[model samples]
Target chain A: MIIDFHAHVGSMDSIGARLTADAMLHAMDAAGVDRCCVFNIFHADAAFGNDLTARFVAAHPDRFIGFAFVTPHYPEEMEGELARVFDHLGLQGIKIYPPYFDRTVEDAIWEPVFAFAHARKVPLISHSDGRDPLVNPNHGEPQMFVRWAEKYPDARIVLGHAGNFRSGRLSSIAAARRCANIFIEICTSWREIGSIEELVSGAGADRLLFGSDLPLMDPRIHKGRVLTAAIPETAKAQILGGNAARLLGLAA
Target chain B: MSTSDFPVFDCNAALGRRHNRRVAYDRPDDVVRFLAAAGISKALVYHPYAVPFGTMEGNRFLLDAVAGHPELVPQFVVSFAVDDPDEVRAAAEAAGVRTLRVFPKSHGYPFVDWIAGPWLEWMARERMALWVPLGRNPEVDIRDLYETARRHPDVPVVLAGAHYSNYAAVWPLLKALDHIHLDLSRFDAANGIERLERHVGLDRLLFGSDFPEVDPKPYLHYLRHCGLEENGLRAICRDNLERLIAGERAV
Candidate 1:
């Protein structure tokens, strides 16, 4: 029951991630992953990305769980887009990239999206980094999620990448500890040793979810991180799929 | 083949502690136990202290720490600014050290030929491998690395800690240079290992964990499932590094 909580399905030539449905399926099969929550964070046009995600989910609904991508850049259309993503496209969750939108997660423009997720009882996953020089660290800092989780207690807000580095990971753990609704998704090139154990110890294993950032990163490696962690088997089971299954409302 | 069956020899691992983060395995016994748990047979270890502190002290500490642990091979850190090249070479010979790591960015030195030429020449002559990590702030200048490796063609220069973001820069260097190799600690690009195998062949790819900073199991698992032949896996997981340490050029 390995469900990758984070992954992307569209091509972003800038990052050399020209990922397709077949490629995702091939990677998942090779890594022995049962399912993945696929989205497109690179798409500037939110509807276009959601359509692509919907198409992937339609093609392989059993294996791919579609998550809708929406940006705060289109403020007026955000509510309508959320409706289309949920009612029309039948996407399960929401994905946000604050760096791409050039807006911090704590900005006023995101209130509508957060409200929508809260109303729908759907989970929202956003890109979060800790002092990364490549992107504006404030755009998706783990600490930013604390206020959002406090504001919308019902919405499950996941800090993607768990702040990326150690400082960010520590911030993420703190954020998760502060708010039960805020979860941590572990997936980054910064494969810090003892990170999983730290996350489990700091923010209970139930709050941690497995993610690969697929088509950019490998699922095998991320899954191997959980499988080989020095934590208890029950914690590993929860982080690997049980927690994600609970979040996605899927039978584990 | 299963990942456990692969004869993994980590080429880029650090021993000793750093000030910034709490390393789980700083002691030799802890490193050995950690490696065994991760299914790693051997590791070429350097001291994490070498980057912040002087290489002389760090290298000495590393040699003494791994004295009783045969599985932990000592990889000395060297800096042209800090130590005399001739003295470093003499000590390396005395210690029978086969590999050396350099931190140009952290040590605040340019990795150009003029500053590094003497060391590179000795390394080339002795058939010793040079390890360059890309994990530092501001990173190792790709052009400087290219020039250094190009100048020292005989030295088997290993570029370690290169993440997938470095693909566009690193892939070309590997393609153009036969002596250049990649350590698979942070090279987590999707299908990256397969792509590297296709472009440069498995001979230039080496297995590494960047341990105490990174876990080894994920990398081992990645290699086991990366769709390579057993021989290719063997080359990357163990044979290539074994060859590099033994001063054998890539065939």
Candidate 2:
């Protein structure tokens, strides 16, 4: 029943900086996880599309879930990348770390990727977590997500950390109630003043997905956050994996 | 467990006389409430007021208030640059202080020099420890502490509130020394634990909260979530702190 949706198999494999395919599977077996969505770092430019992630999922089809690491900044490969990722790599969805690309969802260059994801029903998982004036401030505001939801009404774009660092902007619960299309990934932002309640009240329970920005952070901690929550079992199931299953077209 | 559930000994609360958001010990009752919520039985607290310059009022305020609050274990940072050995001895005796905390103003001169030979000798003689608070705006490099540790083999030099996980410079020096202890006073996440344990080994690491700002429940929550062995978790949560506390003069 435990499915970790966000985990990294980094460029170098170690327990901290890298959680390679084999390491992830072994850790999963040790930790009692049924499945995990494995992501890869394919260099800075996004040159190689899902090579590592695909290889891992392909090798362990029963255990691993794949997400395509696509660069919308590379405008030419939008549709081609989607087809390649979904068709060739067997990725269930697309993972776009836009801030790393220095691009935004509103960029004219990002249109084709959004369109392709919507058409094929592939979810977009990305990070919106950042804050503090001196360092990396978060790029995706809840309102920005609301705008995207309004634009791509059907596409399931998951914003990690319940759109945290953006929590600085939530000011109050009223501000949080603005976005809907954006599902919140429960991982890093599961700390103080955050939980399934905040997500449910702000963005509805269906939009909240369970994620563990694992190996970088531990899954046991992230899993415990979901497992020991004061919410209903149905809500827990939805956040943990049910919603991710539906988005990835996995049989629920 | 609630995020606010554990007993918190905030290693780094700057006492802004009238506490707003920044300081935890500003409201003594809040400290009591924080410990109660998180199941933290006790805490080792530091006051922000005396740290950079070494004032007695904030240390006095904390130690006195915490005395009534048995849950709070207060520590004073003795001045690094005492001109007189008698004053150094007097200050050490006066405060019943744990660490002669230093400020690396760089130009703060002779004071910086004071810690290495005589003051360090005095500190070692008194059996009081020397610690530098590593949390500041312009970060004090890990190398500086490593160098200081190099010069003084007999004196125990530790870095309190030293949780810079991304950096790698401090590792070798930490590994080289048997006496050096790193109070992972602000290990905000559970995931960072495995990496630290791998590098520092279990005994050298101590559990400290930059509490009130960091709720104890998150640590306890990290305890619930970390993929560490039961003994490792127990060491981090209670036993590691006990190891450090056992060495100190609870005077």
Candidate 3:
């Protein structure tokens, strides 16, 4: 099963990324993707975006796997929403956007969600681009999450986009090497040659997951990076779906 | 090993040390092997140092390194640093080089008419190809380069590493001029290839991998599945570049 661990559905206010569930399904079918673990695009209101996500997933359960969007700014109601999405709505994981809120991944505001996800054994995927000069540079730096990883040993944290920018993949690899809990997702506009190989060599094949950043980027480009990698087919299998399935506790 | 059903000629490949990163292409053989591994038939290459350091030294190394490798055609990196017009023209002619790449942003020079005026005239008179590195940096002025191409209509100006956002600007320029072309190394925006082919037509489009910094396999894979027709794919892959290269020899 080829699973895209990172994708987006619904409108984004910031950069104008809008992809409907029908559009997402068409793109997935074209790209030969079996399932997509999707989240709402970046939004200030988590509830509104999460509602769209829940409806999208509920409509196409087999094609889409939902990840609930939560923010620390809503600290008063963050945990309640997390339970409503994951427990009631049947979302599989939690997605966090730190740079959008002008906060770093290591901020204390994330402790409640982190603790909850740790206890629940759900993967926490965060937007971890090393670019974005407007925001704090450390906002998505994979190294910033090491302390959190050490604190919450059970939480499976994914650095989405693998710190998506130039030379950011190396930092993501470094972060994965430092913390066993952090896995790197390969989905970014920047496609440095041998980047996937570097991730496989620096971090194990098991610590890597395939992501398309879909609707924003094509899934085939990300998938081709793995399918044509010089690595063995077994490693490609792990990257394409096995590792992501393992992370989500699904049959590979 | 070519992924596409059609043959491809990469227009924006590079050789030698890449700036700010560890690249696989250190020697000419490395680039040749890299292209061969990707099943690419031909590539227009340059020494990465030619961007930072002036072209005189880097071009010499590039010409020598790719001497025997026909698959790797050397694209001479020239800039205003070599002020003498005769020297630049003589070096290109002696080396049998057809294409010249300029990096004003990386080489720390302004792309003004005074600096490029004589070269532009020389390129037009000689029918040489002028490859301007654009869209890699936000500060790169594609419109200014478009104006420069307007000054010398005879010279074929190829915008290497053009961003997808600049594709809109290409039509207005292309409507007036036929010498302008866009290299698709960094043009990976969603539905980018299909849209460009529809709006600008495939005749002006050229295949580019930006190798050494990026792998060619993915780009080849991308173009293969971008839903282009066989003739359109053939034009982008090989025919368009063949015309460009042939124009150089016809000079």
iRMS values for every prediction: 1.4, 4.9, 3.4
Model 3 chain B lDDT-worst window of ten? B134-143
Error of 2 at B164 (Å): 6.5
- Candidate whose TM-score is highest: 1
TM-score for chain A in each prediction:
0.97, 0.85, 0.94
Winner by lDDT between candidate 3 and candidate 2 = 3
lDDT of candidate 1 over B62-121, digit per residue (tens): 989999898999998888666788788888999899998888888888999989898888
**Cα lDDT, all candidates:** 0.86, 0.59, 0.78
Error of 3 at B150 (Å): 4.6
How displaced is residue A46 in candidate 3, in Å? 2.1
Interface RMSD of 1: 1.4
In candidate 3, position B50 carries an lDDT of: 71
Pick by lDDT: 1 or 3, better one: 1
TM-score of chain B of 3: 0.88
Model 2, native contacts kept: 0.12
Question: How do the residues A110-217 of candidate 3 rate in per-residue lDDT, one tens digit apiece?
Answer: 888888878898899988866455434668787787788888878999999898765567788888998888998998767888888888988889999998877667
Give the per-residue lDDT of model 2 (tens digit) for B32-65. 6656655667666666666544446556676667
**What CAPRI class is candidate 3?**
acceptable
Clashing pairs in 3: none
